[model samples]
Target: MHNIMIICPDQSPLKESEKWLSRYGFHVNTSATIEQANRYYEWSEFHLLLIDQDSIASLENASSLLPSHLRRIVLDARPSLSTGVDSMAQGAIYYLPLPTDSETVLKHVVNALEQHDDTPQTDEATPSQQSDEDAFTLGTASSGIIGQCAPMQALFSDMRKIAGTDVTVLIRGESGTGKELVAKALHNLSHRHNQPIISVNCAAIPDNLIESELFGHEKGAFTGASTSHDGLIYAADKGTLFLDEIGELPLEAQARLLRVLQEGEIRKVGATQSTKVNIRLVTATHRDLIAMVRQGLFREDLYYRLYVMELLLPPLRDRGDDISVLSQMLLEKACQKHKRPIYHYNRAFDKAIRSHHWPGNVRELENAIERAVILSPPERVEAANLKLASHQSSTQQGTATLTQQGKTFTGTTLDDYLKYFVQTHQSTMTETQLAQSLGISRKSLWERRQKLEIAKK
Candidate 1:
């Protein structure tokens, strides 16, 4: 029988896990101390080990006593961002934060088993983006987009139905709502699947050079244009061009872009010749473009052109399966990318997942999972596995600040207070710090910021 080691300070959760693994036909070995786990590691090789977060340091210290690689994983019940990151950087195979489920555990384990080939071949692992070269197959066969919720199913259905057509697409969503993912899905499922999906972030580009970038420029059209160049739109001739933050494009650029959409052709900045394109336009924006059009911030014709088909991605709070689906998906990716044996999310970790309203959506979820993966050891993850080290990030990442209730000062709104706070302590303050000082819960702080319109300074 294969060896399975589980280390815990408490007996109840350990006993529960023992039964869980035993039912799965794993020969379970339990330990109450890190010293015993270390001693056991010397005598036996484990298929998987589950370490309580309290004993994580012990397991890591034991790693130095061994010679070659052994499958290990950590179960952190209280996860701090730093410790999790530090654990992985120090050589842990997998990290599972508290309140995690059996399914999340199973997913990581399967991924890890597949990654460890026993062939003795050296393959360094690194994380990769969700790229075209690695497009996900359709149906329930993939782990790419995680969801069993109605909203996700509907969103998927909408994408599948609209992808095959050449109709322009308008994707509306708040920041972190995965608009880019929808855009990619549209292109991936479309007739132009093989062609490139060129992405241009409208807000990131400056107005002075926006024209030269969208349309080709003749040599000497502007300063430093020593060579004639093809523009981004031309490069995406037969594919889909994703215009992100489309509402940020200035009025002048919007007019020229509208002409291209209206005429299916573009003229160079300084060249007299015009070029035709056979591209599909997919635009996304966090702002309300319809309102913008009414206010003359957006062009009506351009709006109509891209609004032929529309899709809106829901935020993480709205996604009912936030914990199960995303945690499992991110775990699988982490195991595969790191070439480590998988682990499970213990009960404590799962609770946090359910309790926390993810302000950063999928990206934040991914970060949390990644932190768990890194903090964990190669052992299986358990409920008491994770430890939360660093505080929450909202106030730190943005300029949104806060003011004490009923403590009004001259020219001071909550937004102004927050801006000053962010500038002063961004490098050190976490959401916990602010909430602690404000005598509020993290969730309450988030709501207050949103209500106050206290955007990042």
Candidate 2:
């Protein structure tokens, strides 16, 4: 029989859980506190430890007291996405939300035990596992997503529910937050994995030819049309079409797109016949399409069709310690790609990453980590080596620096501040660098420049 220990402050659920486990033939013990649990732990070796939300400082604190052989599961009396992330970050084998079915609890316990039994034992922590308490880990990397933070876990849960269906998904987030990766994950996990997942960046296509690029064009359809060509929608038949920055799509194209979504058919440019296509549509945008709709820049009907199911990706800064976790993964990949020696980071590195507000999100973080790997002298990477935007300027405070005229920043709009800052720094910094420093995506910076009418130097 698998042995178990439960540390709980409440009595009712404790008794209820104990009765349920007993019925399943588990060897069980109970304690009211971590101190009491420690005493109980000294007497009997437990295969698993169940701790309620109230008893421990945090899951990390509970993890410190247990020996490596003893696995853990967390019981959240009040469940929320953040608490679930905290549970996984602390290395809990499973997380059980409150009001969970007793049989569900039993099932999780058995699965945890079986996994623990299957895993090979090691006497000491490996180099990768040796780290400070705040370091994040992606224990669920098999899902093809990298974050173990609460928001990411919540997104992962939502993705699993909808991946099997053919419903249209609109992914909304700031640029560099992995909107494309989320789209790809949905396609890979869906029924059309064998087919090509065609991607089109709406902003990159010229307004004059976007129609022909999205819908196939017959020969001599336009000035340069020498041969018939299939558009992204046609190429993506029997597969998925990922439209990145869909908000930038022309209003004319939006009308056509709405028709395609409504009728599941496409008409080629200069062609009398329309062809039927079986395609799964997934679109993502960093822009506010709703606001654009209000401005008459995007079609309301098209927006509604794409927004049937929405996935809002959280920014990197809001994901807590996931920065550290993603840093390690990116560092490993970068090292391999660049032919550099593997380098571990110091706690100071972890501290710096956790403290900085990642404005550029995952994309910016990946670039910084890769640069550190390339520049460091085969030594352990430190905070300074990463060169994060938060440390970009010694004199600048927060997201923007004070102007030379000493204008009061409190009264200024964010757009004004961003425009002023970019104008001041554009001569010395590239647009990409300037965007990173401002904590906005490059595309956002470009839009800001257009609205403010700032001339590119």
Candidate 3:
């Protein structure tokens, strides 16, 4: 049995967690203070440390007091993006918001311990091997995706496990969350790496041409089909076919795609015979596909086929310090692309980046960095160069005080505020725009609308 230490204030919930962990047969120790934690650490060999925010004065102090060899998990009673980022920066392997159930906590602990055990001991590794391992840990894995945050690290781990298999994958996230990157990484890591990976943007293609483009056409099959042509599906034979924005595909096209997936073959328009193809299907969408299926816009059969394996990408706001890391990486690339000298950004630029809720995710960040690189002076980039809109300014303008019937309301309650803001803005703004303005997910907005009986305009 492995030894584990829990550093937390004498809270009932955490104590309950301790009991649950002990029931699983692991040797567990609980410390109520930093001094006590240090004492326990010196007295016993612990493989993992679970520290709560209230146990120490600050993350910096907690990080300093903990041993470097032990895998650390930080729990926060009140979690925010900044706090989570700081905890990760302090070398915690995981940062979890508290009030989570013991089962969830146990799952994280088990996963962390398994990861620790799987890691090769570096004491006897050669310098080159150590360097390679360090690079992988730093998010320089063969996938070439950059991320050091716990969510991304976990995503990379999942990718490695799923890449070797031939199952269909559905990548889902808000736009600009790098779904394509995940799809590309999967193709690069799969057994069909040598085969061609064809990408199709279903939304970008004209509906009239989508069928012909995907399934091909025989000579004189249609007015535009002057010559026989192979479709994207056939082009991806023995390779991978990536269908981005699959949610936008027409219902007719969806049926044909479903048939292709089921039969592992395709027949061109007006073709008498079917052509066999062996390919992996990977799809991505920023839209709510289930909602589309309900509205009868998307085929349910295709949805089920694409849902074999789902990979969800966390948006930029939830990714914490990855914003800083990605910004710096994008800055260098932007400078090189524009043929400009490397330029540093001021603290104001950094603050603006951290403050803004990037609804566009990494794509927005890259555009902002490139814009700043092109517009800023040779020495430093300023907040103005980024051209980011102030969320606070918008909120202030929208939430101004109102008075009626000899009484004044400042929107004290969350429901009142949401009802007022959403009802007031739903007339002029689209659903997506309203969600972005309110700093919430579209699903959350819809749920709130249902709860408050606020109908969409």
Candidate 4:
């Protein structure tokens, strides 16, 4: 059994977590202040320390009283990016946002203990040092992109291979998968790293203004042309120009862009002379450019010109454990942005996140987490806090209504519904099918089965 100490001013909030930890066969002790925590540390060898944010200053002063090998996790009731950074700077293994459920606290404690067990004990080596090393092994830390999965690893490998070349590259991904980041990475790795990378969102510009925006306009180009203006393309001379949502570009602008790629020149609006320029082009879009070309919505020549090299970014649902890692990272970012207390989600929230398809990808996930962080009460976030049910499919929404013995049961509690549904369906449906119908993972289904004592047929 591992021993843990929690240092906080109030004990009420943590009592539930303490009880859960004890029930799981771990010994837990709570201290109302840093002085009491110091005395407890001196009395017994502790595997981990859960320090409250308020007690951090006092704990810092009493740091010399603790050993280097003792694992420490800071729990913040009012979490901000700065406080979390300070805790980590002081050698904390984890910084938990408050309003976290007991299950989340338990998981963090167990993971911290496991990390302690794995660390090679020495006078110089520490868990934080190992964490830093582990971060590099993920392979895209320097690129400002986070992914440990095989698809992302392959994408990173491809990116490295192509980043050095000046070839026109096209990035394809669902919105919010960070295509712009990939485009920036390509620019940074290329020879044009020192040059400016002008980014333009094609869809954001009006149809009439897009042509003038991409290819500079003369003084008398059109209505409201008060003065001659250099387009974004001219600004990117001898550098990289990234056009996001390229499929949204008007056909007229597409023709102008194609000329720049082929002839290496741009003719400003209302100008008779073409100016010679050298620039690397990188474009990204969530639309199907080929389909647009066929539909006459986009120019085929330009589509072929921009499709020289393609980078396909996988959606969040396909990244497996990356979702969990990203959630924590995004949670911290949201907390930091809003200057709110760090918060954590319960097991139900985690389950909801994993089960959701995340149609909008990482962008949607970030927004959801940010909303939860702002709206949720201190320390813990429940599944309802995420409001994922509103985004669920019609089939998933219908799961609440059950038909049994020629009667419809819609008023049953979640436990009553789960018990009835599983027992009624297990005889006919496969486990995977059952899980799918219930809109949850097989692991969650199994856990519910165990919790409610509903055996499979």
Candidate 5:
């Protein structure tokens, strides 16, 4: 089930929404006060969040100040993303008008977390699984997100709590953190598990059409309105809606969303009558929402509405457990997907995966494994067989830029870069780590040192 937090000054509507969410298998926490919301953020990790528009305004910088990868659903009085489109574009995943019926809203929540693409239906597809949905089959994100690091242990615990309730969750972090996976885990465990989980990328969607995409339209609603249409929010009816990259939503849409959330209704494009819905909302983003609010690019009220129970996903580097575990998992999946028999990596290859910073997190790890498997023989994956551009270049004279901040000695030999990189990650390396860092055999490493006229450590 999902753990949801509801933050609203209006208790009656929030209570009713909680009850409706309960029907779908969610555990919800209700908090009207900012203090309670702050307390919840400190100790809990919620999967989905439902916020009153006014509350969003109040908690402007709350999510930006929190950790990363939180899923949130917002109830806007204006019920549009125009005003706070920057918020969604910055990183909150989905922004929708608060629905009157809890069930309908729950559907939206499900849709938001599950449906990012429209997949053509296949005859072989089962009834319980949607054609285009990419959900992780409930509770599976926990499998990949865990880490042995204490920070990760604590983070996972928080995630469990976040997943346990329906709270407006704001996730803040650098790019490549495990935010989306955390959001999915929350939806899987929530009361609204049976419905679809839909997601929208605020940063990816064009600004002009975002409003129409969220609230839907009646026939003749816009220039291309050939027929009546249901937007992302309505598609997620009876489900969980995940808005990723929420910080980027445009300012005008944010105002409309604020109104819809506050009033618990939405007026679709070209439709005078408001249609009621039930849904659980989850939002995620990598930007600093509070910072944007301060800059006047985000609506302060909308920020408060979404800050009820923010959850942060630690980066892969911060979660060492994920490094090894994810490598192994991706290795297997890559082998299977590529029809390669290679399963085990040589010592050099294993060390490479562990040592890399994994700037793209799990996504990066998966790609690395796929590349290795694709290049390997049918029965084995070895270090040399792997095609890492970094590793390949390191073997040559080229250097790889490892971080931001323009700290670069571009012409330095690959060997120097490796030494620098290894020195930087001393915690992950032991005194005998040079061979591993260079992805070469101990004997070959010595040969390279002599051939390249390199100084031995």
Candidate 6:
């Protein structure tokens, strides 16, 4: 069991958190203040500190006073990019945003303790000390899915809870939030772990062939049916059938799917007999099915059936500290994959990522990292190598957006360009100073922060 000391002022959240962590098999203790927490730490060998964000200014002081073995994690009620960066600078190894669920807290605490225990004492490659190849392997193994942010932690908990059940699940998220990964994780942990999992992309299949693709057609069922074959659903009998981009499923196919769910059977095209299939169904889509149902694009009944257990994945830009961790991991992986010398990323690179909004989420970030790794020279990676702003919408193309008075940018919208400039330069300038530099009122700057979805300093 891992030992954790939570320093929080609010009794309600503290009690709730402690109760849940205890149930999850953790040795949890709590203090109302940092001073009291330090006293508790001196007596007990706690492996981690879960400090409230209110005491964040004192974090560095606490770290200096605590034993070297213990790691500090800040628990912010409303975490953001600015606070996340500051916490790391204050010596926090991890940041947990609120209102986080209990399961996410448990996972982060456990994982942090495990990593601390595994760290080498001497004469070994630490995270900063590891080479490209070693860092790629170590980071990937240690940071699978690349986040401990509140949203991701909640998603992890949901996956764990539903893994043992056979109920159908509908995962909803943006295009690159890794919905397919969640499906695979569910199958891997379910009773059908040993059974084969058949994955099909509904949008990838042509509308004319979708029926034949899902429900096998008999030989000569259509003009080109050369041989009688089992469908994907048939192939997945006694296993799992994962339908990705399920919102793109045709109406005719939706009716067929509804019948299969209702009767536990599938009828092949042009076949007289209906075949019984004992398989678990998992579907995912980035579109809103409810809205589609109202628009007559998707069947209401089918939508309800698939929506039995809805899991909404938070977008990448919302996961505060995760971007930094994931970027490093991706950079290392890209370097190792291409057999290039690893390039170290400086604070400027980190600032660049934190400032920009990731519209394409994880997929876009990985591509950017790979591009940088391939193009950058040996030694270190600079912000110019990232080229993230080039991915902005076409409407913003060739439009000059100024930053820091004379520094003009193109491609990205004014809001995004301003966010990038502010976040990158925040460490050097105060809010009032930055607002003045941009030639905008302080209130206007605050309004921009809200409009652009930026975290306040």
Global lDDT scores for all candidate models: 0.66, 0.75, 0.76, 0.75, 0.62, 0.74
Which pairs clash in the backbone of model 6? none
lDDT by residue (tens digit), candidate 2, 28-136: 8888888777764662366788878777754456656666555788887664444555666667766665556787678668767765473434447665455421242
TM-score of decoy 1: 0.57
Q: Write model 3 residue lDDT over 1-457, tens digit each, in one string.
A: 8788887888635666778788998789888877877655563377778888777644556666665556778887765444555666555666676777877688778867877673323224477654533333324423456675668877888887898798999998878888888888888877898899999987556668898999999999989788998999999999999998788688888888998899998999889999988999999987788887798887888899999989889989998757776776677779889999766644588798999888778887899889888889887876787877643345455454676445455754476778887777667887779889889987777656544546443
Off by over 4 Å in 3: 1-114, 118-138, 389-457
TM-score per prediction, in order, is 0.57, 0.63, 0.62, 0.58, 0.55, 0.61
List candidate 5 stretches off by more than 4 Å.
Answer: 1-148, 389-457
Q: Taking the tens digit of each residue's C-alpha lDDT, what string does model 6 give over 225-327? A: 9999788999999999999878878899999999999999999999999999998999998777887789888999998888878888888899876787677
Instruction: State the lDDT of candidate 1 residue by residue for 1-457, as single tens digits.
Output: 5566777776434346777667767677888776776665543456666667776554546555432344556677666434554544444455666556776665555544443553332223233422421344321323234443556666876877788799888898767677887787778778797999999987556568888898879999888999998899999999999998788788888888888898999988889888999899999987777878888888888888878888888888887644554666567677768887756545566676767677666666676777777767688643332232223333355443344434433333455565445445535666567667667776665545443323322
Question: Candidate 4, after superposition: displacement of residue 416 in Å?
Answer: 32
- Ranking 5 against 6 by TM-score, winner: 6
Per-residue alpha-carbon lDDT of candidate 5 for residues 1-457, written as tens digits (9 for 90 to 100): 5677777886435557877677777777788755677666642356666666566576667555323344556566543223334334333444444445655476557754553322222224454443212333221232434343445545655765666566667776556566776666677767777889898876556567788888888998778889987788878877888887777678877886776567656678889888776767778876677878888888999999888877766777776434654566567667778777637545577777777766566656776778778777776787665555555465566444556235554434655665555445545654247567667765554444332323222
Give me candidate 4's TM-score against the actual structure: 0.58
**Model 1: lowest-lDDT 10 consecutive positions:** 121-130
The 10-residue segment with the lowest total lDDT in model 3: 133-142
- The count of residue-pair clashes in candidate 1 stands at 44
